[model samples]
Target: MKTKAVRLYGKNDLRLEEFELPPIKDDEILAQIISDSICMSSYKAAIQGEDHKRVPKDVSQNPVIIGHEFCGIILEVGDKWKHKFKPGMKFSIQPALNLKENPYAAPGYSFKYIGGSATHIIIPNEVMEQGCLLEYNGDAFFYGSLSEPMSCIIGAFKANYHTESGKYEHKMGIKEGGNMAILAGVGPMGLGAIDYALHADRKPKRLVVTDIDEARIKRAESLYRAEEARKNGVELIYVNTGTVSDPVKYLLDLTGGEGYDDVFVFAPVKAVVEQADKILAKDGCLNFFAGPTNPNFSAELNFYNVHYNSTHIVGTSGGNTEDMIDALRLMSEGRINPASMITHIGGLDCVVETTLHLPEIPGGKKLIYTNISMELTAISDFRKKGETSPLFAALADIVEKNNGLWCLEAERYLLENADKI
Candidate 1:
């Protein structure tokens, strides 16, 4: 069948084209993508062209589909897998298909598996055999595609950057209550990290979120204030890195010279990594949430300090199945609202235009509904064979009034209607 998807031809070139998709085999399942989210890495691939890692070496030489984070429903399942999934059943496809053969066979970034940016994807029995699909018959937006990144955050948290707690003495380290600093980046993932840190039961005494965009900082502060009321006392600061002469010193000044307990460096710039050592607390741990794509790219830091200070530096890529389950639970519990980060909404076609020019958009997540109709389509398309459910129909009304409000309200809607999806 013909399917519409975003294809990368070369550097700075992305096109929405129609192509014939392969049919589903007996042990496989076909999914019609309902929603997808554009990540920073997606844009990187668009700019770097064939050099982007997501593009398989052989496929990079040709036109290949682009996308990793997405939510879809089962359209057709192979006879053998019919018991596991059924038609019309809503499910979220974990895009990272780590086959034994692919080196980076992790979810979301695996070079061997195609992503969910297209209208439909066929899940091979191998993935089913591995058990990657998660069933969710409730309210989930295209932004739900962010589960992978959230899983990465969980992975970073599991890395244990802090020192273990003794009987009484609270030797500050990267453990449960370690302070976290999200630096340089102010998009969906960074925003999501901040939300996760804020709502986490073992949240740090102080959470510092930084970005180059004044508007993003202001929005984050406003959202944090509104979402977290009981913990309203928590300090949320916004600094304009663009105007700051010395960001490192500025960040240190905010910490009162103690340094952060745990730092999440979301920015991929070389200078950010180079200066990360100075801002890090004596025994602080730094989680490089974002890494430079170029294999040749390297960052410099003080090795002597790294060894002597007992500080840790760790990095995480795509998440695993366990992380995704926790993320969904968090979403369902209304702890971390993934929809809040969605700043832009459009159809599949707008992906190339908006996602490609992401640095210009000043907000959180850019959501794309795959089934959206043509006339109503701007960011995503979610119009399937069935009629729009009354629940979503109501959401569309709210989304039209205010995009931000839709994000805030959708989480509540999802929670209230959780059991009835």
Candidate 2:
């Protein structure tokens, strides 16, 4: 089979090219990629290339595709797995395949033909054996693509642990009815964290989301209304910390002078990390959720509180398959909408440039439809582009109807009318 994909040769080396895919083995399955949401991890991988752990060391001779959070449909099922999976079924993958053989080996960064940027891919036996090939029943493929990142947030929440003084056993998850704060929490992943915290079974009495950007804070507040969170019995507040004289003191004041029990640091910045530490209540679990590309990223923490007050820290890279299942279930039930993370849409032809320069671009998720030929366009600009293109005109109408957010209707319209790659 022939497939078109963005392959990584080395650091800052990405090329969109057509190549021949080998026949799938009996232990493999063939799939057609529909949508993929570009992640910051991809940007890190593209810049570091082989230096990235998940990326293969010999990528120059054996180039690998670049993408991980993807959703697609099964095109051909091999005989060995025909009973469990069949052709025509829609699916999403749990890209964090921490197999015993090689924990670092994963799709996208580690594979030659099985990344999300490709038009078609061969799903190997390792993915199915690990139970990472999930059958998705959602009407929108972007939601399926978003499930991966959402799972990461869920995993972070689950990974956070609280402790009882002098006890060895650590209690898992954020403290219920406790004060919680998400520092620098108005970006893409931070928005997902806010959504999961409010809607999940575990609830915090007060949820404070802080960001340096007032515009992003307002935008997040618009998408997730404080009034709506209050209806669900959680006090949600968005604060622009840049305007505050002392962010740590100001955030604690919002919780009635009590420090937060669970604090999530969304950015890798040292100041943000230190700020989260200063606002932790007794037995507070501060989760450093951001993945820093620098090898020697460091931040100072208070060991005095760790010894006396039971304050601790935990970090998670990505969620497991079980977390992915939970993410899909929540999305299917309409409990959490990952749509807030998406800000731009593009096609296969745009993957090379988009992936190479993702950090330079401003937005949440950059969604890619693998079979289309179009430049990366923001949803907010759909109306402005509508003057020249009929595709953008129809998409603008659909987005505006949905209150300026990307929806299934917009995706369907774009897929049906846009030029196929």
Per-residue lDDT over 1-421 for candidate 1, one digit per residue giving the tens place of the 0 to 100 score: 6787777777787877777877777887888777777777788877876565555555455576677778777888889988778988877656556667664443333332245667777766667766778886557654367676677777666664555334433333244554557787466677777777777655676677777777777767766663363363345665676688988888888888778778778877887776676788876888787867667877887778677766668888766778788887787787886665676655676777876787787666676765553222222222231146654555555565654444546434433432310
Among residues 3 or more apart in sequence or in different chains, the pairs in candidate 2 whose N, CA or C atoms overlap within 3 Å are none
TM-score between model 2 and native: 0.99
True lDDT of residue 376, candidate 1: 23
* Residue range with the least summed lDDT across 10 consecutive positions in model 2: 162-171
Candidate 2: Cα lDDT at 244: 92
lDDT of 1: 0.66
When summed lDDT is taken over every stretch of 10 residues in candidate 1, the lowest stretch is 377-386
Q: What TM-score would you give candidate 1 relative to the actual structure?
A: 0.80
The TM-score values for the models, in the order shown, are: 0.80, 0.99
Candidate 2, residues 160-236: lDDT per residue as tens digits? 99887677898899999999999999999999999999999998999999998888898899999999999878999
